[model samples]
Target: MATIRALVPTQLERRMKTPAFGRRALLAGFGIGALGALTGCRAEGFAPSAVPNGNIGSNLNIYTWGDYSDPANLEEFGRQGVQVQTDSFASNEELIAKLGATRGTSGYDIVVPTSTYLTLMSKNGLLEKLDLGKIPNLANLDPEFQDSIADPQNAYAVCKNWGTTGFLYDSTVINRPMNSWADFLEAAQNEASNNVSLLEDPAEIAVIYLAAKGYDPLSTDPKIVAECADYLTNQLAPHVRAFSSTPQNFIIQGSMTLVHAFNGDARRGYLEAENPERWKWVFPTPTANRWMDTWAIPVGVQHPDAAYAFINFMLQPDQALKDVDYIGYSTGLTGQRELAEAAGLKMLDVLFPPAEILDRLVSLEITEASGAWVDMYGAMQAKAGA
Candidate 1:
């Protein structure tokens, strides 16, 4: 295990900006001095026309994935009179479970959830339908994110960021070409055990095995699910160093040479690490899970008005650009799309990927019975620990 050290934000930023250090390596192709400048289109300034009062007060509470947003967004919101409070969760299941447990009293005004959870939350009446009219910035969004499956008709959520789940590795550390799940498993067992980590999410773990087995990533049949569970418990579990919800730390500290990660995160790590030569990311061939995450106001939010105001603020092209630069995920803001692409692979293309790669992307078709992933993940952790 790697001992954790605390670094101030400035220290971390300085590290990430250095060519030999962090994100600078990922920028080798573009050679851009500043990422925020990547948004090629004119950034129309933000004006609160939709809200008559904007009496939303100075406080806004947000629940989101850990380390997912730009602190600059918080500063911008503060300038606009909204004090932002952000809480994070490890998985979508955690987000839904929290909201489900609290119901009307979830206390969170805004939450960033992926497409599936947004749809589920909407259907369960746990999300507030947006008055799209209030958010003129919606026009700035790419058509693909508008009126999405997660919030059909653009009813509840606004597009946040999107990416794919894969893994990043230290090529020099492993000293081998890891192209597919088969290679990943073999390396974990032989060269990388106790030095590699897999995703803590069972849906992702299942996708890895299912892809190796040539089954659909989102198979609904219980039998296929069972096979996935069997592979996870009987094979992958013993070799995995740990099941990490935020596995990027494994790559950062060099405790784990190979790590299951989201493409954006791997890219982020590559840009932030000491050894750029050691870092590499791959979307397992044949297929990978493509994901879209969105920001939504939870139903019965205490600061609904402020939530609207804050979201509108984020949707602005300039603000969205800062987020993509900081977070390394692709956004659907129309003005920022070209800029994001210019930011290059590991940033945009790898997150959104090219059209040919898009056909290989699969979305998880989870159902109520998907609780099995949660239990299985827990069991695997316990077994690994033992």
Candidate 2:
């Protein structure tokens, strides 16, 4: 299938020379100006047109990705007179499902939903309207991130950290070069057959198949999604050894030769691995799912003051740098990105990438096909467990 190419941005035009080169950790990345100050890459200048007065208070109960938020940040938040507590989920879908089931009665003052999930959560009246004045750092965000079409006016969610999904392979285990989706699927069924692992999220894997076959990942077509499910269960099931959102150990410790992992997780695997050179990340050409994990408040927030305070505190450039460094993810906060660079954080660009890539980057969201996607994942899980 011809790769889905979008109209090029000049910034990406310069980057197109080595667009998908994700091999080496030290490859100098094209400047995105997004995190560091390039046009269309930076998130400055798009903060709220007006600020709202938000009540200040102490104590907050937050929910987020299992390892996404740094514990130290929480400790510091506690020290600020706001007693802070946190719970976490493995995936955004898990977080949304659990929170929706509870209807904010769970008493979580804050929750982190990816960009795609934010719209639904907000529309469902699950999230509270954010007071931009309370979050002064919104001005620090790249204008691109600040003006989210999904949560227009920044009423419900403020995207803070973003990353992409792709696979990490142990070069020592699989001798051949694996770049495209075809190469990955081939390895799964043959050389690395039944020895590979994939992320448990159905959408993550489905995006790969959709992109490879030139179908939009965001399509709500039942037939198309059902086909994706069939492909996941029949064609990819036998080759999967395990399915996990947290596949860090599988890739880092050599339990699985090829682990479908987030860009940050795979980078973490490489950084923590005993044999770092043996592990490598691959971002499929034409497209990849670029998602933003955002901070939002539950409808009936227990501590509005603390929630806003905590969000602003995290937006502080130093804290944002620490957050990204610990998680191995990238943020669109230009200030934070520069700090990471000055601090010599390696591969920050690869995890983040130039803004041009965002043009081809797909945003996977809840759609009419959600049910089919879930059923498809259930089938894949059943087979893997069997």
Candidate 3:
């Protein structure tokens, strides 16, 4: 996921900085200015428009990850007289902090958070209970995602899109068959030394060490967590060029040869690269994180009807296809793979992995020990002078 440097203003700046990079940007050949115009909002000095009186208001405010939504969809929705405004968060922590500090008066009607954060957000009364009745398209969701472990009853969130956490390497540079996290580590230390980039996420960084060592990546045991931290600080950190969530740019620039990345971004980087055949994506064995991002309404949502309408509209097969095609992630909707193939999306294997690869993927759960992993990551980064 792309990290937003600041809450709103920085998001606009980042979009402007990389206007012609993402698939949507390339396909439409428009910059952030054009996108803002199409969505009925100005990229500079953007603020939520007045919500006209109605069940579905005239404006919808969305808070989500950067480059996750397609401008075309929002523009199409705008044709119905509902102006759309989107702001981005760098991480779940940033999302939680902004919402918590505002005490639910952030003016955001909808938020897309990773599924693991659903229970925490609901417990804190940060989220509003979703009325599935408003979303008849819920039936269109894949049965597997319908029973989310974090929100099993679908009381608070609906799966938006899902992808795996893995690494990718430039085959032309490495000259080795890289498959597992172990190989990733070795390559990082040798062939890719001083040029490797890992995701800027703590929990994701933990997965690299823990999964490679044959331990549960989500393991909260203090000893295991400490061990992973030690390995990162002592072994992996020296070789890492940068810690970043948006490594696609580095991949495209040919600045980083191997990167720890979410499959979606890796696929995007691969396809966008000048020599795409040099990139090799891996579904690391024997385990990796299979994360799902979800759509939920915040507690003080001002445009509830518009929130429901937008969610339901996105759940439709056609919109979902556009979403997956643009973002390069699975929407957890049935037959999405077939739809994507029919639409001529490249890198189907990376976007929708095989069943065997899926079986090795694991879901991350928020637990009391979650904070320990974050602390370990910080300590590792500090000790390594990263």
Candidate number of the best TM-score: 3
**Lowest summed lDDT window (length 10), candidate 1:** 30-39
Q: Write the per-residue lDDT of candidate 1 for residues 18-85, one digit (tens) a residue.
A: 23221112222112221221112222453543777545566778877666678877766666556677
CA RMSD of each candidate after superposition = 10.4, 12.3, 7.4
What is the model-wide C-alpha lDDT for candidate 1?
Answer: 0.68
- Cα deviation in Å at residue 262, candidate 3? 0.7
After TM-score superposition, the amount by which residue 23's alpha carbon in candidate 2 deviates from its true location, in angstroms, is 24
For model 2, give the RMSD to the true fold. Answer: 12.3
Cα lDDT tens digits, model 3, 1-386, are 12222222333333334323221122332311222423453233222222233246578888877767877788877666688887766556556767777787989899988887887788777899988878878888988888777897799999899988888888888998898998999999999988898776667788888888999877878788778878887788878877775777777887888888888888889888898788888888889988998999998999898898888888889989999988888898999999988899998999998999988889987654566655555565555434
Shift of residue 238 alpha carbon in model 1, Å: 1.2
Model 2 lDDT-worst window of ten: 33-42
Residue 228, candidate 3: Cα error in Å is 1.0
Better of 2 and 3 by lDDT: 3
Better structure of 2 and 3 per TM-score: 3
TM-scores, each model vs. reference: 0.80, 0.81, 0.85
Off by over 4 Å in 2: 1-55, 91-94, 97-104
TM-score, candidate number 3: 0.85
